[model samples]
Target: MSVAHLIGKAGKPYTVEVEKCHIRQFAQAIGDTNPLYSDEEFAKKTVHGGIIAPPTFPIAMSEESDEDLDLGLEYSRMLHGEQRFIYTRPIRPGDVLTCQLKVTDVYEREGKNGTMEFIVMDTEMTDAAGAHVVTSRTNIIYRSVSANA
Candidate 1:
């Protein structure tokens, strides 16, 4: 099945709620020991005035923020090609974040095995106050079934 052609030109947007516990777990999973992320008291002294999440904490909310594409891509053949995040301001606990996402680009490259599909997704995260908190660019490379054989 040609799953690539099924994905429409425009992608869907999604929203997610950010919580303090989520931030703490993400910090722990990433082995980040920063006081700003781990200690509420220490964070209170900083400019943010509260517990602040690490730069990559936004990823933890991806599952909630991602659209249900159901593209039929084989999970075993999928690979994380690239990821980048640009932050306008630090993310603090208790901030309700909403993400707007769209497929910026989609293309295929022919290889000896078959064709490799590249999907690029652009995501913008904003706080409840409408402040842009972060912009994330994610690239996913889907290897053809033939390539995995």
Candidate 2:
């Protein structure tokens, strides 16, 4: 099955409630000790006015079920190629975000080892007030098994 036909396919929307503890944990796990991510008092003095999640914290927000939209790539041959995020505003504790994933583009290219299929997707995160918060673009590459072997 050609996954090229799956472009524009979107998965079910999921919501994630931002929590102070989760934000702090993610910051700590990433070796970041920024006050904005942990100290409410310190953050209160900042423009954000409260604790906010780190920039990369949205990486932790995801839908567990990708079964809704399958690309039909060999699981073992798939690799994460790249990821980029565009944020409208910083994520803050107590914010409820709705996220939806869609396949934006699909293409193929010849690589050093073989022909690889690149699957590009965009996940848009919107706040409870129906405002865009961030959009994360993910590129997934699948190398041809026959060419590699």
Candidate 3:
């Protein structure tokens, strides 16, 4: 989306039921050996009282619907620049989480090869009870590459 139109746009929400299996897979993929992420019984005894996803678990949440921003940039040109997450509560299994994504910032810079466009998006996540759970900000950079190159 164009920065002029996207800035201050309310986040469009995407909801999903956090599954135990998904959490296990994500933890395993990240090489996290924390018992709370994989062992249900172990997690049950912890303070959380149940299996909870990792702090970076939001990365596993797929887009709920096609609300993709039409940035007029090629997919091949995109690169993940940075990510940060702030959590108010741990994500436990069976929690129906809703994350709303909104364009936060857009800017341009000159990279080693060419001009690069940066798009920053923030995802605000909440539990089914509407309690704030996590806020994640991701920056994606798009490199301008000529067709000849």
Candidate 4:
């Protein structure tokens, strides 16, 4: 299969509601002991004024990709290759967020065994006021049986 042919030309946007419980749960799951993510008093002393989420907390707030979209890749064959987030501002509790994600690139390369498909997604996260909060890039590598020994 040609990866270039599988690229999703357009992207669908999704929204997520940020709540204190969600943030707390996510922080606990990652074993993050940061006071900003848990201690309300400690967080209130910070510039954020009240409890603030951890830098990586947005990942937990994101919704899954739309299943109705023709993403063109088998979920079982996909492997998370890498992920990065650039933050413009801190995320505080009760802040509703929206994310717009699009397939930035898709390509296939010959590997030692055969071929591997690479997919890149670019996501822009904004607050309710439409202020850009963060940008995240996710990469996935799909390796078929022919692409691995």
Candidate 5:
């Protein structure tokens, strides 16, 4: 199946109330020992005046069900190409975040082995008050296993 057909497709909307534990757990999962994500006392002393989620913590909150973002390609043969995040402000506890995902682009280019397909998707996040919080762009690469074999 051609990934081009997926361009313009929209995914399920994801929302979550970011909590202190959520930030701390995300930091721990990524092995980030930053006090801003864990030590409330220390974070309170910082310029933020409170603890905050890691820059990439939104990834944990952006969830898409099977009904969305199904590229109809070989799942095992796919690879994450890249991830970029732009943040307006630090995500802190008590903030509710909502994300809308969409397939922004798809293209093909020659790889070391052969032609490869690239799928580009984006998630725009907003706070409960409808303020833009962050925007993430994700790139996924897919290749056929038959070619590798």
Candidate 6:
């Protein structure tokens, strides 16, 4: 069966409160030594007014779940193709955000080996006031069984 029917399928939305520690840890893990993500005093001196998360901090804030939408993909044949994030404003500690993922597109393409299926989705994040914050688009590539042979 094709995954075309899941184009608009969305998962359960979950809330997460951005925290100082998590942001700081994520920065450190990614080898980012920017003071804006660690030093509150330094961050206070900057335009952001306080410590702010790094551009990729939302990845740490999001949770993976199969609550509602399931692609029914073969785990062994799946490969992460691409990921891009769009942000309206910088994320700071104490900000509460709700995130939900929905399938946007599903298509098949002829690869060098054989046919590959691409699943595209977007994870949208919104603040407590229902303002859009960030949108993370992810693409997953699945190798068809015939391609393996």
Q: Which prediction has the highest lDDT against the true structure?
A: 6
Residue lDDT tens for model 1, 10-122: 44566677778888889888888788997888989989888888888777766674455566667898789999998998887777888766677778888778788888776
lDDT of candidate 2 over 1-149, digit per residue (tens)? 35688799888888888888988888889899889888889999999888888887777875433455666667887788998889999888888999988999999998787677889988899999999999888888877877557
**What are the clashing pairs of model 3?**
none
lDDT of 3 by residue, 16-83 (tens): 88888888888898899999888878988999887888888887663553476554557786789999
Report the Cα lDDT for residue 118, model 3. 83
Q: How many residue pairs of model 6 clash at the backbone?
A: 0
Query: What local lDDT score does residue 21 receive in model 6, on the 0 to 100 scale?
Result: 92
Cα-lDDT of candidate 5:
0.83
Query: Which stretches of candidate 2 lie above 4 Å from their native place?
Result: 63-68
Query: Which window of ten consecutive residues has the lowest lDDT sum in model 2?
Result: 62-71
Where in model 6 is the C-alpha error above 4 Å? 64-68
Q: Provide backbone clash counts, one per model.
A: 0, 0, 0, 0, 0, 0
Output the lDDT of residue 12, model 2: 85
> Which pairs of residues collide in model 5?
none
User: Candidate 5, 91: how far from true, in Å?
Assistant: 1.4
Candidate 3: residue 99 Cα off by (Å): 1.6
Top candidate, metric TM-score = 6
Displacement of residue 41 (Cα, Å) in model 2 is 1.6
Better of 2 and 4 by lDDT: 2
Q: Write the per-residue lDDT of candidate 5 for residues 26-125, one digit (tens) a residue.
A: 8898999989888889999999898888988877767533345565677777889899998898888999887889889899998777888898888988
